[model samples]
Target: MKIRAAVLEKIGAAAPYAQSLPLRVQEVELDPPGPGEVLVRIRAAGLCHSDLSVINGSRPRPTPMVLGHESAGEVVEVANDVRDLRPGDRVVLVFVPSCGGCVPCAEGRPALCEPGAVSNTAGTLLSGERRLHIGETRLNHHTGVSCFAEYAVVSRRSCVKLEADISFAEAALFGCAVLTGVGAVINTARVQAGSTVAVLGLGGVGLNALLAAVASGAREIVAIDLNEDKLALARELGATMTVNASDEGAATAIRTATHGGVDYAFEMAGSIKAMELAYLITRRGGTTITAGLPSPEHKFSFSPVSLVGEERTLRGSYIGSSVPVRDIARYVDLYQRGKLPVNRLMGEQIGLADINAGFDRLATGHSLRDVVVF
Candidate 1:
């Protein structure tokens, strides 16, 4: 079948992406769903930093790849072996496709499924196949979910069936931003009521963390970001206080205000500097969690003595250390009940043709969770 999709022909393009135009919206051929796979008519896809990382050459992946992972769609067809889902079912696409037999999957950590990681790194589906092509040229899949198109063929393991009543635009966020952000607080940190918390970066993921912190009953939730607009939004979203990362006294002010730092600090900006700041804002015996995906070449250094003396815990969360099949449903339930309030994080809705310009907004750190509606 022929489909219109945003294809990233190469990486490391000069910014002002509206001009460089790294992603080309062009027609491509999509194969039918294989066994254990499903064909989905993409209803909405969100532009996230993970996608921006690829465009800026920070997080490198196989190029000439369809460039979206956070998306929601309606099932159009299912492979024979996939009996659990059928056409017309609304679903959220998960970037990592877990093979149930893998070690991580068996341990209730599907996010780290060995096969899923391998396939994602290789830019293939769980079955190790490419279903996208342009004549004789085959294009790589983006984390087994090349969803920046009208349609996508993905492994069943890469999808979570949605039972909640919500728009595809709202549901698309659960696939990535909501999952990563909320999951970081609820699943990874398990933030307890009355505990002090701080979140850095305030992008889609960071703001979601702020919302989750509020839902979890945290006593003091501090929002930190370089963008003043995001800080203002954070204040409205129940943050007890907001700090500008660019402020010279940002760390000192947070430490003083929170009485020597927060119990938990999350780094969602995907930058080494954010990670360092998150670590600094964690009080003694507190934990600092980083879900940011900076360049693989980037490294962060810290004093081992601080870990031992302060009894500080530093952990890395991938997809919020989430079990998508379980967490996505639970988070959706929270959203419907007005607990998560993810809708407040939504930004502009755009068409596929304006994707390059959309990315420019993302690169500038001024956009919210912008969606491409089909």
Candidate 2:
């Protein structure tokens, strides 16, 4: 099959996202799934900060790569031996696919499966072949799903079908931000009722973290951010208090609001200083979860002696430590039950030609999620 896609021709050159993506509409061949694979016709895709990370060279994606990870669509075709999936099934693509036999998978950590670790990062299929290419240039697609275009060929394990009631636009993010934020609370932190939590940085992930904290029954959810617009949105999403990070006395104010310190703190802005503040404002034994992606050279300070004496837990979570198949459906249910207002998180929906606008908005802290609708 042949389809159109927005290819990142070179690195460091700015894409014309406000008007167009410099996306040359090229037709490429898509091989039928080998072993366990599915071909999806992408409907809607959530524009993630990670996608911008690759284009900006922070993630170091190979030139001329097809970079898209979070998306939702329908199964147009399925490979033989693919059980529980068939053509015409609506599905959400999981960037990380579970093989079910890997060590991590056996330990109930399917998101950490070995196959997805290297392959997903390298922007290739498990078979190590390029299903997307133009002429002799075999472009590397991001993960199993490259939904920046109209269609994506992914592993059957990566596709999770949704109920007829859930909209594709909303379900698109279940593959990334929603899972990362909600899963961190439900599956990773296991936050309990009456606990106090602080979320540093009110971005897409931060907003989800606050909502998850509320869903987990945390009594007080303190939101920290420099954007007043986001802080207002955070409040509606269940943040009991808001902190302006730009203020000189923000740290002291956070401590006061938490009644000395919070039981849990999440750093989602990917700022080095935010991470430090997250650690500082936590109670002696409170947990600190770093959900953001900072620069490689960025570093923060923490006293090892105090860290040990306090018995505090400092851990990093990946995509909310989620099993996509199980958690995506659960989050969809959460949205239906009115516990999560996912639509509020979306600031706008732009076409593929204007994909770069989404990234620009994120860079300037002007938008929540600028979804890509094919």
The residue-level lDDT of candidate 2 at 235 comes to: 83
**Candidate 1, pairs of clashing residues:** none
* Candidate 2 local lDDT, 1-374, one digit each (tens): 77778787766657445554534446766666677777899999888877777776666766677778889998988778887887878998887877788899999898898987777767787656567877777888787778898888887777888874877888898888899888888788889999999999877787888888988899999999989999898887888899888889888988887777898999988888899989989988889998787767778889987779989998888889998878888898988998877777876888887677667788777689778887
Model 1: lDDT to the true structure: 0.95
Q: How do the residues 121-227 of candidate 1 rate in per-residue lDDT, one tens digit apiece?
A: 99999999999999999999999998999999999999999998999999999999999999999999999999999999988999999999999999999999999
RMSD of each: 0.7, 1.8
lDDT of 2: 0.82
Candidate 1 wrong stretches, greater than 4 Å: none
Poorest 10 consecutive residues by lDDT, candidate 2: 16-25
lDDT against the true structure, per candidate, is 0.95, 0.82
Estimate the TM-score for candidate 1. 0.99
Worst 10 residues of 1 by lDDT: 242-251
